[model samples]
Target: MPATPAWPPKSAPRLFVADVLSAGLAVRIEGNPAHYLARVMRVAPGDVVILCDDVTGEWAARVSDVGKRDVVVEIAELLRPREAVPDLWLCPALLKKDRFDLILEKATELGTARIQPLITRRCVADKLNLERARAITTEAAEQCARTALPELNEPVKLDALLAGWPEDRALFFADENGGEPAAQAFAASKGSPAAILTGPEGGFDDAERAAIRAHPQARPITLGPRILRGETAAIAALAAWMAISGDW
Candidate 1:
């Protein structure tokens, strides 16, 4: 006989829902998610769909009803518990809209525990749409098969951010002027509460740099010899950190 098909097949569409999922619970998905399932994916009754409630983790659900504007699925079984993300946070200076969006999406995929947008003297953009930002992260998480979502934070001025900096957490500053190598510094500080701070396109102003360096928790780190754009630095630094100190 042929081998049995896998539960929650790999091809099944994945989504993040607001409801706390439990076995046998009937979940009513509406709005955009419903449209995606019923119209885009063409899911019908008996179809298996992967659902994740940021709180309870991932589950296998069987489609029970489908309507023009909604899709209902009954939770079947838990696939995986919510994952424990690294304690590292990405504190990147807000760049242009598209650039910042890339940072948010990639950061979620790389598994940063939190994202704290910074407003520096040289930053071209200082505002973020939390709703749109959350949607980008949610979609990225679903695409990456992540069971938990990263904590998205509002943008704060550089001074305000530093003022409230936690004493226990290390802040790795990506300085264009140069400092300790990123890989080496990250390796030495593994398994600690940490955050990476990358500057904007124009880079941090002298006073801003001084202020950051003067912080007790700051550790200036260099990405490499070449200069990187705001978005590139944030993404590169995050990837390196994840491989060195974060869960890879």
Candidate 2:
């Protein structure tokens, strides 16, 4: 006989739902997600869709009802439990709107457990739209097939962030002036909760550098001789850390 078609198929549309999902429970999806399924994807009754709750994990669901503004999916089976992200947090200085958005999206994909935007004196943008930011990270998680969403934090001033730094967590400061090698520093902090702190385009001022250096939890590291953009430094540091930390 011919090979049996894979159940639910790999082509099924995936989404992250906010409600808790249980097997055989019908889920009513509305708002943007519902519109995407009913209008964009043209999902109809009996169509397979993958749903992740971020809390309970991922599930396979079949569309039970499709309406103009909403779609109902009946949860079928659990795919996998929520993933355990690395204990690394990304503390990047806020750049321009577009640049910061890029950092948020890429950081989520890179498996950072949390994102703490820093408001340095050199930062181009300080205020962030929490709703929009969460949406970006949510979309990124969906696109990357990530079951767990990284916690997005409000922008905190650099001074306050250092002042309240957790003693158990090491803060790796990417200093343009140079410090320990980035790779070596990451290796030393392996298996411990860590955070990478990068400066803005203008980079941290002498006072800010001194403040960070004096913080008990801060460990300065060098990204190399070449200057890097704010966004580049954040993404590069996160990628390097993930590679060594085995989150890659």
Candidate 3:
């Protein structure tokens, strides 16, 4: 027998929908996606779409009808079950639109339970559109075969985030001048429910650093010797945390 090929070929596209999504899903594709499918992809009646509900996992649906304004697909059987996301939360400072967008997409693939956009004094881009960010993560989850979606918290100032920090969940702040290396610190901590914080272009300010350090949950750790970009730091920290303490 031949090896089974991946469900989605390189040419195929997939999407994530809301929960309890089974057959006969009234897919109302609007905006750019609608245009792309109707005009570019040239999908018509009987065309297929790969879908996941972030609950029941993924499915294969076929287009039942196509209109000048919209398109619809008949939901098929549930293909895969819900993915088990890690208990790790990613608290990365806002970077440029493109960089932050990339971080959100990759973090979703890496199994982050939640994503928090932090506001630091050095943060170049403090304003984040929650709707857009959520959309990005949702799409990412579908593409990466993840059934569960990462929670996106509203933008919070560094102080506010630390002040309301949960007692049991340790906050692992990635510091250049640090307490210990990530691997060593994480190994010693025994996978304590953690949220990894990475700052923006200028990194955390003096007062902000002090406040976070003072928190009971704060565990300062170093990434490496080389100076990394804010975006690089965020994803790197997430990767290390996931390996040491998160879902493999």
RMSD of each: 1.0, 1.0, 2.7
lDDT-based ranking: 1, 2, 3
lDDT of 1 by residue, 113-169 (tens): 999999888888878999999999999999999999999999999999999999999
Residue lDDT tens for model 2, 1-248: 99998987888999999899899999999999999998889998999999999899999999999988889999999999999889999998888899999999999999999999899888878799989999999999999899999999999998789889889999999999999999999998899999999888889999999999998888999998889998999999999999997477
lDDT of 3 by residue, 1-248 (tens): 99896654445557776546866666676666667678888887877777777777877777887778777777876677877777889999999899999999989888999998998898888799998999899878766767789989999998888888898998888987776898888777765677889888887888888888888899998998988888898888888877887776
Off by over 4 Å in 1: none
Candidate 2 vs. true structure, TM-score:
0.97
- Clash list (residue pairs), candidate 3: 23-75, 24-75
Clashes of each: 0, 0, 2
Q: Name the regions of candidate 2 deviating beyond 4 angstroms.
A: none
TM-scores for all candidates: the values are 0.97, 0.97, 0.89
Query: Candidate 3, which ten residues in sequence have the lowest lDDT sum?
Result: 5-14
